[model samples]
Target: MSTSPRLKTQDTKARDAEYQALWQACDRASRKQEYLCSHHEAKRIILESACHGILDKRRGQGKIMCGTSIVSMVHLHLQRDVNSRLLAEARMSRFPSPPPNDMPCLANPVANAGNPVGYNDIPQQQQQPQRVSPMISAAEMALRNEVTSLRQDVSLLRQEHELVVSSLQILTERVAKLEGRQAVLEAYPNQGIEGRNAWMLVKPMSPRSQTQGRDEDMVNKAADF
Candidate 1:
């Protein structure tokens, strides 16, 4: 029972890895863009390189990639990358920098660790603007997607299990009736009380009945004893 969902989760991890690879590929493409003109083909070429770039450049080019898709993916990746950088720049610019002669503000005015004060000790406002990684958000979104897929898979599995249980219950009823008729026919001439009893004895029983009449003789003897 657990095997199904465990497999699904494992599959989900694989799914997550696939997207991660794409995102990583996209990031690599965005950074190593060969052409500076924001050319779609250029971005696609860069991304394709990340995936198939291990080969010699000439050989890699010879290998045909589905460029339209690559361009679309890289375009989105770079767009997000640019957007994040812009937002970071906007935030950094929001604050005015202190004059060169002014004392830099420090969150920890006193060096508690005995470390000397330097730019490292300065507050974030005074620090150089760093590119905020979009990976965290991308990972979170992927996790949500994975969880959603897992739920869907689990739900379908549960429904199938329920259907199977119900189907078996129905099939059991059908088999019991059919087998009784078969047993009676097999005992043609003696298809009376004895044949009915034999059919009842041999045919399948439901969970509730548990073949209560099975081994009746032994049970009776035990009771009497």
Candidate 2:
């Protein structure tokens, strides 16, 4: 059956949309990860700068206690910022929202807690036997029997073919021997010449004359020749 072109186009479009959405989500996640890394780096640099500034101030004041306290506070703040950004990133990575409670799980048809559409309530469809005419059934059985007979006939034919091939091989050998004998006879110059002369001498005679002449004289002439 032919499919509707429009429907096929729509289906393709839907699949493309789904793929595009997935790709976009992946791109966004990647960018977010990059941004988080950059932010973390920048925060570290800022914390380092704060510590260095505090140390320089302590050197001018000749008091290390205040510098240490300020630096520790700055480090604590940087740690808090890093943790918060990590938490935000984790939350953002939770993508393509989970399936709805009403949706069924295609993978596991036998419903569990994950699938709300329970298999228990679904009615089982009983398959009915297809009706067949008695004549048709008889015809089918006859055809099957005929096919079986044909198979046997084919096997017999194969055996016959093998026998025929063997016979041909024997015949070929016999023909080869006969041809060799004929060649040897032809190769005998005297015999070939005498045979040709006899044929030439009798070939011109009429059928009746040839028969009539086949007596003592003809025999004596043949012996002489």
Candidate 3:
């Protein structure tokens, strides 16, 4: 069941080659002035494709990659020449901002007995408030609202579809029942008006006709059979 190191190395090289191809594709897409997607979008597509390939390969090999490992792989492959520190900072920003300065850090009471903490002893770094574009915020809000509306619309449409299907099913059952009655009536031609009425209910269009001649002929044939 053990895999050879040579085979492992070959697999690793093949994976790296695939990622390189994805990077090349992103670069080519960026160079195309007429490309419909933006540079970031192209990069996103390449990353997604590469991730999907990795996932499929992992499944085939019966191996599972940890979430952090997968994320690290994606970051490494996509931003090969980018600063690792910058990427770390970007990821940190995605999490909840650090607790306010007033919040106390957890420490052993016994260890801090002789050394009382003070604001003067604390380190202070100049912090700048990050500015967000109003247009981008507005667009994001609009998109969220649009997504909510679409979800509601989809639910309503699905309910309507179910209702239509149920109604058709009921109609089908009724038609089958009417057909069974018609068959019985045909076997006994002298069954009377009730049988004829059942047939009329099943085929309602017979009563509302542009041609009386055709309708009469149909009724006569039914009565004869």
Candidate 4:
């Protein structure tokens, strides 16, 4: 359940490494490009590499990758690489430079006006930009996606549980109604002596008593008429 997405089958791992190398090359080649240009080039490189494996200039042609699975894996890796790069660049841009060392109290003010302090003249140390690794970025993305999937599963389970509980409640109420009806039927004979007699008549009779009862009822009816 906790397997890393990076640790795939042996062949898959090999292909993934190859793809990473290709993307890294692309990253280096496009470093001087503008944001949108770099992004588009990265995408193009990824698609080309995924479709037609890594190219070997010495060999003069691209080796074809075997399946869509490998291509898709490379696509994800490329996206992570791009994201990590963008994040690193953003971090680098966000940090403000330390203030220039208070211009050495020059005894002579005439020296400052000749060359308005160029950035190169600043002796202050520049903060080094923190780098975010692609692997770390990939792991973070994987964890986020996993969490989202789990939340969806939990929501579905809750809905199913509620449905089951409602069904059970309906069955329980139906059973209670049936039991009440049965109790009413059971109490029918307690109404009066006439009810008791009616219940006795309603009860099942043996074959001989059935014939005798039918004959007695007909005789009584004929006499009354």
- Flag regions of model 1 displaced more than 4 Å: 1-3, 33-41, 48-75, 88-225
**lDDT-based ranking:** 1, 4, 3, 2
Q: In angstroms, give how far residue 115 of model 1 lies from its true place.
A: 58
Top model by TM-score, which number?
4
lDDT of 1 by residue, 94-174 (tens): 654444444555646365667565334333444455565444444464456556556767998999999999999999999
TM-score of 2: 0.24
lDDT score of residue 169 within candidate 4: 100
Give the per-residue lDDT digits (tens) of candidate 2, residues 123-186: 3354555444333343464456556556767998999999999999999999999999999977
lDDT of each: 0.58, 0.54, 0.56, 0.57
Across 1-225, the per-residue lDDT of candidate 3 in tens digits comes to 999999898778767765554454443332333222335446556555656665566668865343323445445544652464366456555644454475456555566566665213344564565554333343464456556556767998999999999999999999999999999877653322456463443323433443345777887889999
Instruction: Report the error of model 2 at residue 136, Å.
Output: 10
Q: State TM-scores per candidate.
A: 0.28, 0.24, 0.27, 0.32
* Tens-digit lDDT string for candidate 4 (83-202): 977987787557555655656543445556765542333355756655644444545645665565567679989999999999999999999999999998886643213554644555
Q: Best candidate, lDDT-wise?
A: 1
Model 4, which residues run further than 4 Å from truth? 1-89, 92-135, 186-225
Residue 133, candidate 2: C-alpha displacement in angstroms: 18
